[model samples]
Target: MGASERVVPEGARRRRRPTKGGTVLSEQLIVETTLRLIGEHGAAALTVRRLGAALGCDPSAVYRYFKDTDELLLAVADELIGRTLNSWRPTGDWRADLRALGLRMHADYMAHPQAAMLACARVTGRRHEIRSVDAILGVLRGAGFPDAEAVRIYHVFVDQTLSFAALDASTLALPVRARELEARAWRETYARMPAETHPHIAATSGVLVAEMDRSGYPAALEMVLAAAAGRLAHVRSGPPGA
Candidate 1:
């Protein structure tokens, strides 16, 4: 090794084992590095060969932990679930709790936009994923929704949040310059549309521009929560199966 070049300390560099190069390789390390690569270089950078190069090991070594890329991707998705659920600090109000948790999930996915693009639709069937489903259903049922209604509402709540998050993250995962340009589209394009050509847009353009900087997910989430709350009230007062 050259003076500036660091040596690859002996740690099964040529073998498929726990540690590699100078680092102790684990599921967490691989997942974290995969996310970092996706964040820094987009999802395309997550190939086994690329990861091996980054970790200073052979590409085939990746199989020691994950059987293949799909499993690794699921693990990455599960990690996102862990982070989102872990951060949630629920308020007593069902509406408020759902809103906060939904926003948290959205923000968490957006934070890793490249990964979100691939993993948002994945059902990990892991601990984090199972617990999250249970918790959401529990919250709704606890708030007076019967089992079937609670399950239906939970599906809507999660699907809406993840679907919108994936859409937003695609834009966010773009190159920084591209993201800036897209971010300004509402103001730079729609807000400037001539009033004579589009009266309704002109009338509300000011408010549109003001709120364009805001994400639509939060508002959409509130609508879902409010609708569920209303249904719960009805269900509570109505006779059984009425």
Candidate 2:
């Protein structure tokens, strides 16, 4: 059959895109290319025209695989989440498993700060995201929490991870000079605050100066996990079916 009339096998549909200018394309290729563009040149380089140029095809070819830039971006975000969870094999220890997941999420996103700045808050509804939700819920339920409690804890765990990842990634995305200035603010400004005018900050200024530049994600993740553990215990101790 002629190329235009040829039917892509059902299983191949997800991986294949229509060709243009002798350049073969696929959904995965576009997503990977967009990631490279964002990583190398920052998020500002993510336009369809730029993507098409990188792919050696006309700009419209990108739309053949993704409905629009927003849709394509959601795919990109999902790809990041997928990579973090792809090889992750959860041990039976729920808390430790969750801690590992949270750290991986933060580290991966922070590594791709430009992309994370755009994608961290998105609800991709893609395969990887759905799988992540199911995995977390499984961990909670396996630990003996009821469905309702499991869902709530899942929200807290996932949202806290993503929120902190986004926040930290934003800081990482800053120019080196800007980040350096921010790192110095606590030491040079807050640490110097007058005790009479800013009693609380003045008192904690030493600790703040030492710790303020660090990402708070690890501490925040631990707090969420600890709170979830407490909630699980409370549920276990409640009256039967109460």
Candidate 3:
């Protein structure tokens, strides 16, 4: 063959093999890349085009894994929930286990603040998430809660934990520039409020601003556990008059 038309080896004529790192993407890779993008750019900037650009592929590549952005967000949520499950374990002390789960979840979301906000309410019914819900329910039931009560407590506990984490992440994901503006506006608003017109607000202003940095998730979770335990105790104690 001519120099430009070199003879091909028996195996060399085959189409180039896809590299393991090629643009042929998997759902996990898409979710991971999307999460990384969300972490750096926040949810609003995580369009199909942007994600595809980051992944070094065509925008249509994402569609091969997820039908739309909502599907992609659901996948991201499932991935976060799976991460939480991997880090959580029941330590025999139901209340303590619940508290640990809450704290760990908060920490994980804070680690990926923008992604956490984006995936907050998108539930995928993924196996790991279902397993987590079941595990929490089992703990409540083992703590002497009836099936209905266990389900109720589980719903409240999971919802409260996720909701607080999302809210915390949303605040943390705010740009420093936006935060400064918000801080200035808050100070101005607080300063203009008449003490006589809003006695409780005026009285609590200092405490509110001072304690804002303190983590409230632990306290809030403890209160929830206390309420659940109290309700369980009352149910088992027979009537007060008895």
Q: Please identify model 3 stretches exceeding 4 Å from their true place.
A: 1-24, 183-205, 239-242
- Candidate 3 has its poorest 10 consecutive residues by lDDT at 1-10
Give per-model CA RMSD.
Answer: 6.8, 4.4, 8.9
Clashing pairs in model 3, backbone N/Cα/C closer than 3 A: none
What are the clashing pairs of model 2?
none
Superposed on all Cα atoms, model 3 deviates from the true structure by an RMSD in Å of 8.9
Two-way lDDT contest, 2 vs 3, winner:
2
Best by lDDT: 2
Top-TM-score structure, candidate number: 2
| Per-residue alpha-carbon lDDT of candidate 1 for residues 1-242, written as tens digits (9 for 90 to 100) | 11233323434323445444677666678789888888888776568888888777776666766777777888899999999999998776788889889988998998888999998899999889999998898888788788889899999999999899899988787788997887688888889888899988889988988887767998898889888988988987899984
Q: Model 3 — TM-score against the truth? A: 0.80
Please count the clashing residue pairs in each candidate, in the order shown: 0, 0, 0
Single out the weakest 10-residue window by summed lDDT for candidate 2.
1-10
Q: Per-prediction TM-score, please?
A: 0.87, 0.89, 0.80
lDDT of 2 by residue, 79-118 (tens): 9989999868899899999999999988999889999988
Evaluation by lDDT, superior candidate among 1 and 3: 1
**Scored by CA lDDT, what does every candidate get?**
0.82, 0.85, 0.77
- Model 1, stretches more than 4 Å misplaced? 1-21
What are the clashing pairs of model 1? none
Candidate 3 residue lDDT tens string, 1-242 = 11233333434433243323464456777789988988888788778888878777767655645667876788788889889889787888988888888888888888998888766666778776788888888888888787888899998898888888888887888888987776665566764567889887688777765556555787889999999989888768967433
